[model samples]
Target chain A: MALKLYYDLMSQPSRSLYILLKYANCNFESKLLALRKGEHFGEEFTAINRLQKVPVIDHNGFVLTESVAIIKYLSRENLIPDSIYPKASKQAARVEEFLEWHHAGLRLHCAMFFRVKFLIPSIVGQPEEPKNIDGYLRRMEAALKEFDTKWLGRGNNFITGNTVTVADLFAACEVEQPKMAGYNPCEKFENINVWLKKVRDHFNPYYDEAHEVLNKIGKNKFKMASKV
Target chain B: MALKLYYDLMSQPSRSLYILLKYANCNFESKLLALRKGEHFGEEFTAINRLQKVPVIDHNGFVLTESVAIIKYLSRENLIPDSIYPKASKQAARVEEFLEWHHAGLRLHCAMFFRVKFLIPSIVGQPEEPKNIDGYLRRMEAALKEFDTKWLGRGNNFITGNTVTVADLFAACEVEQPKMAGYNPCEKFENINVWLKKVRDHFNPYYDEAHEVLNKIGKNKFKMASKV
Candidate 1:
């Protein structure tokens, strides 16, 4: 019996997991939980995740929620790495640091990205506000600058160093947005572009499928609108 | 060289780590990163954690951010139980799941708590905004009610299972807000109170230490003024 993933392609992390699973060749059943339709909050869906969030998973009798954890779980279950983890005890802690901060820091950018682009019009029924997006872009730009100055070393592939941690994948998928939102990515943070290219070069096969999924998010003609 | 943690007592996660460190007896040099002074945004501090957030561990050359990651590092360093992580893969994954969800769901209560009780006065300079507090309390009440209905499994000690995983510590410390906020813990949910007491009993030393540090917050005596 394969584990079931409750996901939405429109979600960044969900798209992430979709990419990850495609690469790993894992056969977990994909159950689409559409947030646009508020399917995540339904009683049946709530039974799977009491918290009523997307990107939940059920493996055997055990159930889990939260995308980062689900990604890590899948990573560990497959051939991802302990390299994404710290080699030394302290480095492992730093990975955790990034993951935790990712929630408040990088992840905030993704939410702001969607909210400004898609959410206000479709979900919140508000005009696409520039100032709100400007504020978030400032934060994302600051984070990218820090990524260049602090976390990204002189020559490293991933966020916590080389070897493609989930942090890299997480950051790469998110940074792809500034351009999509008409906020030039390369101009904002040069190193972020460099790091992003590195992530894509190594993770490109994964991205081939993911880009298709992400492209469908705004444009309805792709596979997303046609399928569940 | 003991790891140095720069933190303010008043911070939700900083207090959480302070308690964890105390209970575990980790060799860590503690520094108070006072939020009241906007010390977190200072150049020197941002150099330590570019996120400019607290509960970071500078271990030798590597700086780790995020309290959840720090806790796991402590666990691997054997400050806590190996059983907390367990040898079983799925079981360990469950722990991470709870920790991941901890931020999204549980921390909303803290967000509301800070926005109402702390930020309104601290940022907006408003005095005793009962309406702000009521908004937070109502949200917390709803989350806790759901937690009771879905999460608790008849006297489960921690969020995941019987043992005091990192999840329990994070949840317990956050739930302690009720005492300070003058909100009723038992008015709606029985399980949260039960879980609270369980962790408090098992991790009393850490719990009590955090309480001592946190009790000092919001008091005017301690250089409690903002520079930023």
Candidate 2:
């Protein structure tokens, strides 16, 4: 049996995982879990994940979830670069560091964008809170500034001083969400735009397939976030 | 030069890294990045970690930050067993699953507990929004229920299935925070209570000796949280 990747394109992490798997050329059965349709919350999915979420990877009988860990696990298998997690223990520590901060910073901003523009409007039936959205956008720009000034550290393919690691997967997928949700990521942070382009082309031809489906959301104010 | 840990006891992740390092008997220099004093935001500290946060590790010239990444990086050095991260991709994925969910669930509770009960009261001189606290607590408790029911599987001594993984370290530290901020963890969860005990015996002793200056709060409520 091939490795099975359970995910939904709607989820940022799941999309990251899907891209990684696709980029690595890992042959696996793709399980589409649309949480909007309540597939992830179903009993069968619950039995497998218990968390009732997507971006789950099951190898035969063994099951695993969490995109970061899964990405590292896959990377170790020569799917991506072996250096994705860092070569030295201390370097690996930096990778871990970015991973830790990424959640609260990049992850939060991207999620907030989707929540404001997409989730609230489409699912929750709530109008966007401009104040909240503005707050999140400001934070997103700040993160990109910090990313440009600090983690960019002279620019690598990923956030932690170059080389495509889980960081890129995270940064790309997350930053893309705002676009899907109708926000301009490229215009807001030009540095992030460069980073995104590098990431988009780093794997080259690799992410084209994923980006095709991902780019369906119209480019409007959303393109203003990152200055490409 | 021994490994150097730049930390602030007040930060949950820094404390977790400290405890994990101490428990492993890893020889390291301890440096305080005083957040209260605004020391972490300095140019000097920023060079150490661009994120300007604690829970950072420095081995010689190499630097790394983020508590979970730091702990896993240290634990991987063979202080703990391989069973922690698990060599299997699927098992490793499970660790990521918990860690990712941890950011939203456990970390949120811990952050809210600190922000509302302590930081707000201590710094801004205002009580936190009660509704905010209650909402997070209720959500956290519900998450705990789901974790206990399905995630724990058939084990003891850790947050995940059987052995202590990065999950436990991330969780135990976060769980302890609510107690320090005046939330009782032992309100009803039996498994969480039992598990907290193991962490206390395992990690508390280390913090006792190494973190001598800090008037660490919440041991009593740790007992409360572990009421089972």
Candidate 3:
């Protein structure tokens, strides 16, 4: 089976899928897109994906977009373990619930905070105003609180239950995003910190490898902010 | 098999599932919540769903949230048809792709437009500022343009393909939402109007039934605006 993945590590969902594929021991062609350089919008990539989003897959000739959809497709083909995405109705629903909620919940607030605090400022070559930064921070914190109380407070080893699933990976990536903006989620949400560590420990080198670019950028951002 | 669905017709996903259940001929006890009356926030409903969102399900003792997850669970149990949510990998991926994208793309923009232009104003007892309304409209229109070009323009009679799947149901509900704010999508986007008509015709009676409340509110809002 000829499979090709187009992704950017800087993107959270992209990283989540990257780690998932690695964990599954699936070998496929990696067609990385440099999102910061606007490569996703070019004619070639746009032809591959009309949506022009990263974390898309081309299996043989069939192309699929959306990370969650791609992951489910892969699971259906038996390319990924059932443990990562269960086949049982109830167990699978638990994971699916988190995946669906993640879009508008953790993902939205975390992405918004990162954009307003780090991405926009870097692109425009200026710091964001305190009020705008605070607004996004508040939203991010509220989502984090929900994640802590509702998700982790379930007293499971992961988001859905004792076993780690894609839900945990997806949530961890989103929580890690605002680190580039000098906001550490672990500092505020204790349960999230513990759960994140467990997910990272399970994924190991793959998790760290997928986040290399983000971690470097985050460290640099912190150093620069400290100097200012 | 004791099954119950907690939903509000005013909620898009709730209506989507409601129609899906009816379309599948599944017998489910309806537990409707009046969102306008803040019924979802009551202690009784809160115990059923910690998220306090509609479109939740209880099967025996198992409780599930999120419409997409609930639909998938139902499909897994053979409670729904293969035509509605294809089990074949490639075909199912097509439906999953639309479902995944719907959350952040069409749903977000359309809901934002409705909230800003109608819901908030109704609750606050005043009209929204023109600037705020314009901002959300632009975002919603951009999302609609993408939907028209990328989704409906794929040369298929429906969002995924010729068959009217749950994807069409979810998309149609979101597209219908802005009508409450006096935004008729059919007027601006010809393709959406045609595709929407097809979905409505395919699932009529049930479609019309699920949308009764929204349609009434939409007409009343239009009448109120006309008087102004």
Candidate 4:
């Protein structure tokens, strides 16, 4: 059963699936792409995924994109345990609920803030407009506020429930992105800070492993800013 | 099994799920909310869903939101036929791929275009800035182009395959929205135009019935513009 995962750790969804695959103990070849270097646009990668996005999987030639879909697909194939992705109809729906909401909610806001505040400036060799940064930051904060109140506010240990599920993994990964832009969500949102630590601790080694590159970049970004 | 669906027919996802439920012949109680009436904000509706969004379902007291999640949950419980949602792993992934992509792709752009061009203007009782409409229209057009060339361009009759699936329903509903703003996709993209017709014909009465409110609004919008 040849399974291969093409991902970039810098990408939030890519890191989420990477941590998931590792936690699930699924044996798959990791084909990493450097987003900064424009590797995803290469002919080879484009052939694999015409969308030219990361977090794609090729399982014995049945290719799939979209981290949410891929995670669920893996769960259906039993590569990931039901504990991580519940099979019980209602339990699973709870996880699915968050996954679907996050697409336009937390994921969109966090990714946008990261891109506008950190990525675009770095790539273009100049800082983005303060107004643009502030706009995206506000949207990100509003999304985070909703995330803190609606999802974690339920008083559960995690997004869906006490146990860490794929929902937590996806959320935590997205929450970590703005850190690269020197935005600390943990500083403002108490529940998010606590839940994030819990999720990271739950999947440690793999979680940290998947984020190694991003953490390095984040630290470097902070150090450079401090020096400036 | 008591299944209750709280939805606004004007909402695209709500319409998609409404049509799916009807097509599947599921006995469901429809709790329609007139979104423009601020009914979703009332205390009674807030008690049902604090998010105040339509396309929510309460199945035997287990409430779920997010149309994609609701559809999948129903499919898992056998409320939706496999032909519509597909049970096979690969086939299901294909449908899921489009659903996930559309969240930020077609859905975001199309919804934004509709809001900027029509809904926002009507709600505020004034016209929006032409620049705003142009920007959103450009994004929507780009998204529609990708939707056409990538999703429907594979010479397949539908988004995922030859037969209509949940993916097609979601896309068709989203595609129909820009019409309210006087944007006719059929005139620009032949593939989308054909596929939309096929999907609507397949689901017939349900598809047209669910679209009744939006279509009426669209017609009035056109008539008013022509008069102007």
Q: Work out the TM-score per prediction.
A: 0.80, 0.86, 0.98, 0.98
The TM-score of candidate 4 is 0.98
Q: Which should have the higher lDDT, number 1 or number 4?
A: 4
DockQ of 2: 0.57
Error of 2 at A137 (Å): 3.2
- Ten contiguous residues minimizing lDDT sum, candidate 3 chain A: A131-140
If candidate 1 were superposed on the true structure by all CA atoms, what would the RMSD be?
5.7
Whole-model lDDT, candidate 2? 0.70
What's the CA error at residue A172 for candidate 2, in Å? 0.7
Give the CAPRI rating of model 4.
high
Residue B212 displacement (Å), model 4: 1.5
lDDT tens readout by residue for model 1, B1-228: 757888786677787787777766666787887787899999999888767888788767667778888777776677666655554667778788777876756776656665576555756666565774777777787767766665665456677777777677777667655544445455557777677777777777667777774445533322334321
Docking quality category of candidate 1 according to DockQ thresholds: medium
Q: What is the TM-score (0 to 1) of chain A in model 3?
A: 0.97
Segments in model 3 whose C-alpha atoms lie over 4 Å from true places: none
Q: Roughly what TM-score does model 2 have, to 2 decimal places?
A: 0.86
lDDT of 3 by residue, A1-228 (tens): 588889999899999988998999998899999998999999999999989999899988999999999998999989889988898878999999999999998999999999999898989999889986888888889999999999898878899889999999999999999998899899999999899899999998899999998899889978988999
Q: Stretches of candidate 4 above 4 Å error? A: none
- The numbered model that scores best in lDDT is 4
lDDT per residue for candidate 2 within A157-217, as digits (tens), equals 5676656776776778777777766665677677777788888886557565566655766
Clashing pairs in 4: none
Kindly list the per-residue Cα lDDT of model 1 for residues A143-163, writing each as its tens digit. Answer: 666666666755676677666
Please tell me which predicted candidate would have the highest DockQ against the true structure.
3
Report the C-alpha lDDT of model 4 over A58-99, residue by residue, as the tens digit: 999999999999998999899999998999999999999999
Q: What is the DockQ of candidate 4?
A: 0.88
Is 2 or 3 the stronger prediction by DockQ?
3
